[model samples]
Target: MNSDKVLDARGLACPMPIVKTKKAINELETGQVLEVHATDKGAKADLAAWSRSGGHELLESAEENDVFKFWIKKG
Candidate 1:
């Protein structure tokens, strides 16, 4: 899917990815998609939980090499 915005949170740890993702997602209108690239292993679980709690849809996620990519649709 196409993303409206892209957030690169690679090399960050813990809540940084979540924090940046939140900020970036807020900049988009409803129904828009945000693609986030993060290297933190914990970002998977963190973003998943954050998305659910924030009422956003976690459309897709995948791991390539050491990077994690997430496609989230704003709700």
Candidate 2:
């Protein structure tokens, strides 16, 4: 998906990725997408839940080469 900004949260631990994602998404206007790259395994579930709770849309997520990528659209 197209993204307005990309945040590299790779190598970060639990909560850190979510924390950074929150900050990054906050910077975007509604409907803009934020792409997050993280190494934390928990980031997938964390980000999904976070996005829903924050009224944002978790557009897509995937893992490749041990990196987890997520696209979130600001609500």
Cα-based lDDT for every prediction: 0.95, 0.92
Question: What TM-score does each of the candidates earn?
Answer: 0.97, 0.97
What residue runs in model 2 are displaced by over 4 Å at the alpha carbon?
none
TM-score of 2: 0.97
Prediction 2 global C-alpha lDDT? 0.92
Runs in model 1 deviating more than 4 A are none
lDDT digits (tens) for residues 16-52 of candidate 2: 9998898888788999999999998888888999999
Question: CA shift at 56, candidate 1, in angstroms?
Answer: 0.0
Q: In model 2, how large is the Cα lDDT of residue 6?
A: 95
Identify the candidate with maximal lDDT: 1
Query: What C-alpha RMSD separates each model from the true structure?
Result: 0.6, 0.6
With candidate 1 superimposed using the best TM-score fit, by how many Å does residue 17's alpha carbon deviate from the native? 0.2
Supply the global lDDT for candidate 1.
0.95
